[model samples]
Target: MSAMLRKWVLWLLGLYFVGGSGAALAALPIEHWTQPDGARVYLVRNDTLPMLDVRIEVDGGSRRDPAALAGLAAATAMMLGRGVGPHGGQPALDENALVEAWADLGAQWAATATLDRLSITLRTLTRPDLLERAVALAARQLAAPAFDAAVWARERDRLIAAWREAQTQPDTLARRRYAQAVYRGHPYGVEATPDTWSAIDPAAMRAFYRRHARACDARITLVGAIGREQAEVIATRLLAGWAAHGCEPLPAVPEVAPLERSQDVRLPFPGAAQAHILVGRPGIARRDPDYLPLLLANHIFGGGGFTSRLMREIREQRGLTYGVFSHFLAGRHAGAFTVALQTKPDQADLAVELVRESLRRFTVEGPTDEEIAAAKASLINGFALRLDSNRKVLDQVAAVAWSDLPLDELDTWTARLAAIDRETLLRAWRRVIDPERLVTVVVGGQP
Candidate 1:
């Protein structure tokens, strides 16, 4: 009954929040500081709701995984929730007990790893009682994940089964090949095989967690009704265990190298109704100087949906594919600038050529004044809506925090987008992408 009531209350809060995000976003004032314990913190105080969202970013993404153990970072993050050790006179909580505890408090916590970082997120009502317990429980999970042998065995098997199932899909197949060619000889190219999955043991996860998920590399972003003082206490408590090891230097990761020449991988999928096509090239990092211009350029090129040039030519006029779009990944290191779409197997060749040609023309001629204006209006208008609720606000805050962007990024987002002129946007786009050098993959249309 208590959990149900909590859900009902939170649901009501969400609905009430739906209408005010634009205003909240335009006026978002982010506060930034470093915790004495070495954890960097970013806070956005939104008092409209009695709820909080907390995200902890660690430098433990898949890119840190050893090639032989391709999924180590993700597995280590998953273990954080399997169980937690006893602390603060609290009982040890297994996965089942952990789930129940969060339910009782009507709060939520989860740990996940992506290509560049491992993130642990917690959300809870800000009522004094609920928030305190939620923090304590999350602190245990962050500091003392048990990495139990039994739990790891179960998780390893489940992961392997899922990966095997994904291998049977056409998109995954094309993506695998695309990643391999695009990220060749890089950590991102390494795929997890069943053998690689089975090789991971509880001990490995523990060691990886200790080395990468340390105080020195931790970043915390909080969005809620909390003030600077309370936010400090919460941040400190979260890193209590992490501070024990002290700050130390971590090894460096190499950058993603651009393709020297064009590479295309075409595979035949017999009897498949459609061809899955992926075209990509190494693109910019989050902190790239041309980030804003390229971002807007991408929108004019393909990311604007129906209004985009790629969509205008390929889908609307040519009747090639029902949908087509493109975007840059923009991670810690260079990620792929990719275009993806599916069409009838017979139309795949024409579709791929059109995409390549469209990119070539856009690179040389660039977006027209009319297209630039429309893209800017769309991007600028939609910026505020991106921060409509606490969750949405938190996501943007976390990105800025993780990318080490200016604290006022949210405040200046639309302004910068609005300031970008046409020549700058074109130069930024043409400077980064060489349509001739794209690594294209086509799967299907077997002879």
Candidate 2:
């Protein structure tokens, strides 16, 4: 064989084995329903694993907190899992019981404050007995949390100390500052001020919960090791007692006038070696038409790890930062596109420049052919891993339902990715990201 022909054979074999033969992707078949109390539910039955993960999301999130009570939503969210039923044995007790009942029936709970909504999530094993107990606990948490003052004080103090500690960390400070600046007047932008947090008494939390935690404003997502029959039974039992709330309207979100702002926060850490920087602005929401396109584009831009543009330019080529990344965090109402990095205080400016320039170039020319193709391949090929576990599958299901996307959306993810070309991507890039409006915040930087 000729020398050139042998090299060609080797390359083809490598591509076939590495990129062709074993790449497989799976899509979840999503189903939807509306409960008698007006709550929406999305279910994906994947019996491959013996686990059930459920997430209950509401339309009122931190953005719903009044200016005088900024942290009210978060405080209310915490109260949901604490005390429920008589003897305060409703939620927290049943929750603990469910965990101990089934060793393999692990369960977890969490909540988040977002521009558009607040979500409470629970994961449990799908064993019939285990699932029933899990549902009962969730129902109690939803329908009858006591909001006891004693528990409230303890949790509040913990949160306050946590917030204080978070303030001391350079990265946390930078992120919070960026959110405040870019989101400005909007509920999406409000910071957890000490005043707002302190004023959040139990009465205020009770009011918030009474107003926001209702059947009319909720969504329940069920995924994994479950079918339609099982999902419906669980949904009905969990959501049945959530009385419709006649609560007050959400706090008005001020219209945030976009601006280019820059500032540096100096902490007392004299010997701290790294400066954490965050840049960007209030961006697209979940309903934006360009959401999917930009999602694909971002994976190539910076969300794709070592293969992303920011990592390639900032870390691989220049070695300015250990890791640099950018992403669009879309919520029900509003989202933010954030570019973040940490570097030696002295090299901070240089790292910021690299991020700025990369974004500038991305908006101007978009991703190259190679980058686009590779990103699509990576996203499509690796998409199945997202469903490898019931918990992960349920997470996506919750996001889809909360975002109000079509029930069959996941099935279309691959085709949608395949549909994009260079031109399509450049158009998407322009719509979602604008380098000129980027807001930069640096914390713990050099003199």
Candidate 3:
């Protein structure tokens, strides 16, 4: 094999043997710095392989979409890599040209939009020349997006069609209605309906990009075979000319008030054999003190696969459905805790009641000592998988940067899990979860 290929193989083996251990993985050092233009940078130096992963996250995501333009943030993110204006009086680069430029250097790039941030990630070999070129290309994309009208028209139509197609699916309908029920007048509840899409023209998209994608709001996370000094230089160069102009700070997410009473809504789906049910309510933010405890508690409650109470009681014993699972999607602001299930339409009502009972039991009685120990063991042991590679570590680092979490959060994860006892778990569950106020949405049948 080539030398690069052999190096990669050995690196993979080392990660499997060394990073596979929870303690060793957590001990990896992370460095932090800031650029002159006010962009924050986080770095982890891993010289195991000759590759680098860079992510630029801005505080602009779907939640920032204007009231009239529901999909504006997503559209802006997608357009960033489509085309760029002429740099230094040179010719412009279109989407295909941009792809070819990266391909020639064995690099890859992508853009993603979430509720709280828009992230652009680039991965390239760490050879000085290749790294320099990749950084220049990314800078162009971020600083001088063309927002071509032709490209916007085509992509907009495609997005609208995808939304229309999703509307026909039972699960999608249930999720949309569930968001509406849980978030009611909040931005989190907004979805890209047909009318919302109609209001998003090219000009509006350009305006949204300018108003949200500012350097001041950016956070950079670099991982792989690079040092602290090189990372600082790279970050500064990549963001040199980018500035915050006409940019507005993201509005604070409103507090999610508890529901006064339980709400249930059912929608019809013609000829669907199975029912899609969603039970949930507003959940905690990522920064909440009870986040970790609730996470561990939920694992025993429903997120532990077959080992969880919901799976064992609702599926293994009673055979009400093929699968049942629950999750808490903690965002920058308040998020959602949801239990989702699919079952034959005939068993819909019983399945809903069973799920409700299971939640109530979990909330009131809390997890047993045995259940808690098993959950702690599973979570603590499995965390090594989350840091097995530079890519995974970069993702965690980016999340910490964007969410303003403690830099040592990953290092202390196992210790925190170990500290949760029966009382702690019960207190967190009682404080954050209220089974009586959950909103339920059933699609494809009446429950």
TM-score of each: 0.93, 0.85, 0.93
Q: How many angstroms is residue 90 displaced in model 1 relative to the true structure, after the best TM-score fit?
A: 3.1
Off by over 4 Å in 3: 1-26, 244-248
Candidate 1 — worst ten consecutive residues by lDDT sum? 15-24
lDDT of 1: 0.86
Whose lDDT is higher: candidate 2's or candidate 3's?
A: 3
lDDT-wise, the better of 1 and 3 is 1
TM-score of 3: 0.93
Off by over 4 Å in 1: 1-27
For all candidates in order, the CA lDDT equals: 0.86, 0.73, 0.83
Weakest lDDT window of 10 consecutive positions for candidate 3: 17-26
lDDT of 2 by residue, 215-291 (tens): 77788888767788777788777766656465345555554555655444444345667888887877677778788
In model 2, the runs with Cα more than 4 Å from the true position are: 1-27, 87-115, 244-256, 260-269
Q: Relative to the unseen true structure, what is the C-alpha lDDT of residue 186 in candidate 1, on a scale of 0 to 100?
A: 81
Give the alpha carbon lDDT tens digit for every residue of 1-447 in model 3.
765345544543333333222433324577887776778999988787899999988878888888888878888888887888787566799988988988898998888788888888999999999989988888777778888988888888898899889877899989989998998867778887778877887788777777766667889999988898899888887776566453466667677666778899988898888999999888899999999999999999999999999999989999988889999988877788999999888888888899899988888888889999889888876776787788998988888888889988876677677777899889988887888988999999853
Tell me the number of clashing residue pairs for each predicted model. Answer: 0, 2, 0
The order of the candidates by lDDT, greatest first, is: 1, 3, 2
Alpha-carbon RMSD, candidate 3: 3.5
